[model samples]
Target: MQHSTSRWTMLAGSAAVAAAMFAFPSSAALAANATLPANDHVLRVCADPNYLPYSNRAGQGFENKVAALVAKAMGRKLEYTWASYRGHGGYSNFLAENLDARKCDVVMNLPYGDHEESYTKPYYTSSYVFITRKDTHYHIRSMNSVSMHSIKIGFESDTTPETAIKLLDLINNAVAFHVASNPQASPRELLQAVQDGKVGVMITWEPAIGDFLKDYPDLQVARVPSEEYGPGLPTVGYTYGMSMGVRKGDTALKHALDKVIAREQPEITATLAQYDVKLLPNPRHVNFPNQ
Candidate 1:
């Protein structure tokens, strides 16, 4: 799933194009005795002001927590550059407005392999999950599960999960939700459909799953396995790495952020766990420290 708050939209390529178009500073320029903002002592973070479980204006999201931790560790205060992401062309210019414009120094959460900017070592991995209430008795572990074709699945349109469902011939039995249909629509809407018995299951990104499951503990989550992928389902990976994003030329800042990530690995895990974030295998060989 594409990170940076919402997973429903595909903006990775657009962001990369914006980065190139903006003519952001090169690595050489960034490495030439580059330093943090003079005398500010602030960690400027770029984030979506309304996207939950990732960031919000109130600083309640897991990314907000991690950013705070990083700032505290570096003896700097936390500052925010609130950029809104409304999916597609609505507010998809975050790369140009925030990073390239120097609105903030770092984006706290971005897809690890995203080419839009320089990335620190991956901090965590997550994926889309199948969500169903416990009372439904619908055990969906993989695409091969017998219940796959029988249940009514709800998912956001134009997502990896939706593509997989189509490949499995489940689209006819699926309810497709669209972000553009209503600017306020969210994973909550899909989860509510399941709760109201409108759909038997909902497949969505893990962060939203973790957030909504807090209020509906009876809901079961099944992580989509990588081995279940087949022909015509090229976009449906079960897991993806996530990392912090910095401007392309900011190698010095990138290295410093990486060091902070390694030193604060335990705190970062704890912060994500506090928000019920479902963490996948640590690609950096870092284990979740003792709580």
Candidate 2:
């Protein structure tokens, strides 16, 4: 589902063209310095300001913890390049416009499993689910479950949920509700709908759901599995593996960051837990951005 932040209307291939058009020395420059610094003092990180459960300026989100882990791994202080990701094109736009501009060296909390963007390597993994009242028997553990019951499920359009429902054939049966009745809806609306019980449940990643559950005591949540995947869809639940986002051709930095993530996984997981973030069945990749 798409969030209702800025309406991200892209001109198709905008991301690719943006990359091709914005090609400059920054990508190569960072790639050259990808090696761990001898002193381990500072690692500039790009983060979203308003995205919660994942990142925020408050340094309370999972991404903040992740940044700390990376910093610790590099023996550097964590510095941030604040950006905003509020739409379909927001991520690509932020990466190209900001990170590519050399404002930051690395981007955390990106989708590692999706083909939308190339990634370094899997650092953490997670799945999506429906957050609802414990008493609600919707039992949305799979696509078939979604079809068997009459549910008014709400999600952000243009997001993973939208993509999942479209492929699952559950759209017809789902009281398919998007945050916006017309063009799109914001992330807040979906959160509100679930919190207010306007909808039986809202589809979301576990990280986001964990935060919601922490704040709201009465809600119950369930993760969908790959085995639940129906025909023509992913066999497993929507597994979101997260990795650092580096510009294309920045292989040196990507490789270095990959090693950092691999070596720091334990610390990263601990930091996330300290922030009250939950990784179901263990973090398969890293940093579930949905939260």
- TM-score per prediction, in order, is 0.81, 0.72
lDDT of 2 at 260: 88
CA lDDT of each prediction against the hidden true structure: 0.68, 0.58
For candidate 1, lDDT tens digit of each residue in 162-228? 6677767888988887642344755577677878888888877677658767787667888876544
True-structure RMSD, every candidate: 6.0, 6.8
- Tens-digit lDDT track of model 2 for 223-248: 65545345564333355565677766
Give the C-alpha lDDT of model 1: 0.68
* Winner by TM-score: 1
